[model samples]
Target chain A: MILRPQLQDIKIIGQYSGRVILGLGLLMLIPLLVAVCLGEHAAALDFVIAASFCLSAGYVLILICFTHKEPTWKHGMVIVSLSWLLAMFFGAVPLYLSRHWGGYLDACFDAMSGFATTGLTLVQDLDHLSFAHNMWRHLTMYIGGQGIMIVAITFLVRGAGSALPVYVGEARDEKVLPNVVQTARFIWLVSLVYLLVGTLALSVTAFSSGVPAVKSFFHGLWVAMAAWDTGGFAPQSQNILYYHNFTFELITISLMLLGSLNFRLHYALWAGKRKEIFRNIETVSFFISIMLLFGLTAFGLASAGSYPGVSSLFRKGFYQVISAHTGTGYMTIHPLQFVGEWRALSLMGVILCMAMGAGACSTAGGIKILRIGVIFRALLEDIKRTMLPRSAVVMDKIHHIKDIVLGEKLLRQVALITLAYIFLYLLGTLAGIALGYPLKLALFESVSAGANVGLSCGITRPSMPAALKITYIFQMWAGRLEFVSVFALLGTIIALVRGK
Target chain B: MIGKNFVKIWLVFLGISTEIMMTVFIMLCALGISWLISGGWR
Candidate 1:
């Protein structure tokens, strides 16, 4: 029998979600201050109006839904799913005010894309966008990458018990520290350190590459946030291509790769367990997968004679493979080049890389390497079991942060989530094909969106069908949350409608 | 006390450097293969 959620459940979900929205309002102040300082009066006005709306709405929700009760697991899931939608809607206010987007829906699309760390964009005249607006775009990536829940848990949410479900609901299951709050803080510590190092490195590179001093600093900071977040948004429209400097690309490659690493691995290394780098399953799978896929991509490009020399091929070809594999989506080549220049084989390699993605509990998206590694091990165990005697036991284990026996329960959970991702990928591909895009291009863009990798094969544009845009938005949201929380949200709606 | 702090910081730096170097090595290996297959040395 399905039990309908009570008013108390609604209160609990509303209270926590209100707190997140309140936190989101506070976050907008960073860019607001930037606009005021830069004398971007027009942009400052947009942020002012948007921040006021968020603050007002957040306060009203908190007041009406006031509750002292701690949220149950169901409430936590509902809050997370609802909070992200609220974030996308309210977050679009300032963006819509900027008028760079075609409509409010377009603005919401970019906001969801930013929060999902998917780099797909539909913004027009991106080059002429104001500095304050640019700051907000990349800021969403930073906050979203670390997670909005992490910010709230680290600063706003009290009690580890309350924070845990929301943290898990954000699709981050592994906690680096025992307490969820400590884990959030530790994640912050790592990112903040990388922010300093990455920003400084990129800033110096940009300056050396001939960007003006002030512009170089802002560009560096923005790019660092995007790359380390494994988000593909650039301050300029051309993305990494705008720099056209090899050193700049090299720095971004390092940042993106580092960004996609599991935070638990980061914690392990920081705590002096250096050997974990070599022993960890995700790293092993990542290394093997990248090499095999890059070989295929290289071969495809080679047979096509896509570029002239080794330098061009390595810089252009290998960069995209890393970008796709890490879920970073920062393209060195133009979008149409994938369709026009690269053969079907190379595009397929990139699509497969996007589908597999990078580490779990990090900014990168897709069916993470941890699950891929486990599934592969499970397959081997199954093969061994078939060959052995009837009474023989196939002892299967996976070495993640530590060695763990792979039980039936674990395999079932992994298989379900992996299937969900495959379904999400196919859904978007069908939507693209329905809109008259070719099969290969449709599949490439769909996997890119569903995996939260932002690479485009020239399909994403302001002019695409609204149905396609909405489909991609849903794909990004569902893919980022990993299905469970979204299912909880759907179940709640069903109960609200049908349950006695 | 200051020396101990310095040593800890240096080790963290070293760990990060190791990760970066490893990634770079992978890229170089890929580049080498691409070079060979594309006959770039010629």
Candidate 2:
């Protein structure tokens, strides 16, 4: 493994460059194979053409430049950041070669959306999309959601310094074990097992219920990807609502719940320590919050008389609740239906669920579960202190199995960041409302996009105002990393350009 | 906060996969070029 310490001081950049060049040559085959196997000769040729250019450039860099045995933090960050950038560069080749995009940035945006699992689209027509393109889009979601970085940690390298920080950067907090590679292996195993199980289960249910076997399998494929990674990429243009079946809705909801629970819980369950499974504060908070928020949304929907049938209400209500809470963003009901008909409180409820996001070390976005647990615990301590006598001084502590951490700093950081997230949410909302979108619809779309909750009101579309699209894209990127990583990326870039 | 060092390490690792993809891309192209030089498909 080549470790780049500090950005500019990347050691072994020359040595490993050849290996990287070699690796790129190999990975370009998957989709190419898929294209050929699927009988899409044009797609195959397109991929072949794009593959050549990228491979050639990568080889030149690897063979000519220095790749040392060590890379500093700066170098590692530079490499990783540049790597994703380069991925977007190389990834765009397929999209551009297909002649689907007008400009490379647009292609990059679409590729990033897929790789980031943001699910938002710039594709002008979903109904008319080529099969190869469709397959590629979903495949990117599956890859990105499992995480391209964690894939590397699991597949290519086995080291602490290289894996730990990178794993965290991929938006995971390792709880089941200390070793990053071990944690990565555990996560991948759990996810793969779940994916296999989920795909089979959904496929059978969908098939038995009358959908064609092939269609059912594809549905299973995309939904499994979305549910496991908490990515909201739907197989059909209509999203989850396309099925509109109670059985399908129930199956998706179950998958979403399974995926949103923290991976630590899975580890504990696997280890046969049943007691450790539920004791994690994040798990408890997630369930409690789900019950409270879901009940609130259901109540709002019921009261609105939006669904004449009880079944219809449950279909829309439960799906939206799970969708928002998990930050999976797969909507069962169109935002057009919910507008004005649904009250402000219900919208707020949905938004709050999205803002909380999935548990740590999971693909779902937003503020995450552990930080919420921290802030909630901190709040409880403050209330208790107020209830006590004036002379009382309270020492706050949060305990995990490893140790009891007692400090106001961690709580403060969590609270401040959560607050900042809300502020950003508001800014996005105001930007939309200011741009002539109706009051409620604009806020809903902005919050939905900003929170990485794939739900949207009437305003979100391929032809959405370009300014609005830019806002949503920023929101998606910022929300996916919870603001901090993006800031880190910015700082690193600035430091590299100016500090050197 | 999003740790820069952590995300960087991740990116480097992910790049490995991308690197693999890039490598694979080259192979296919090489095959295509060879096939063309070998008299294109008869």
Q: Give the winner by lDDT.
A: 1
Q: What TM-score quantifies how close candidate 2 is to the native fold? A: 0.82
RMSD of each: 1.4, 13.9
**Model 2 off-target regions past 4 Å?**
A1-28, A99-105, A390-395, A399-403, B1-42
Docking quality category of candidate 2 according to DockQ thresholds: incorrect
Q: Compared with the true structure, what per-residue lDDT tens digits does model 1 show for residues A250-339?
A: 889889999999999988887778888889989999999998998899889988989758888888888999999999899999998999
Q: Specify the highest-TM-score model's number.
A: 1
TM-score of candidate 1 against the unseen true structure: 0.98
Worst 10 residues of 1 chain B by lDDT: B14-23
Residue A89, model 2: lDDT of 62
Candidate 1 chain A worst ten-residue window by lDDT: A392-401
lDDT of 2 by residue, A199-223 (tens): 8978887888788987688678768
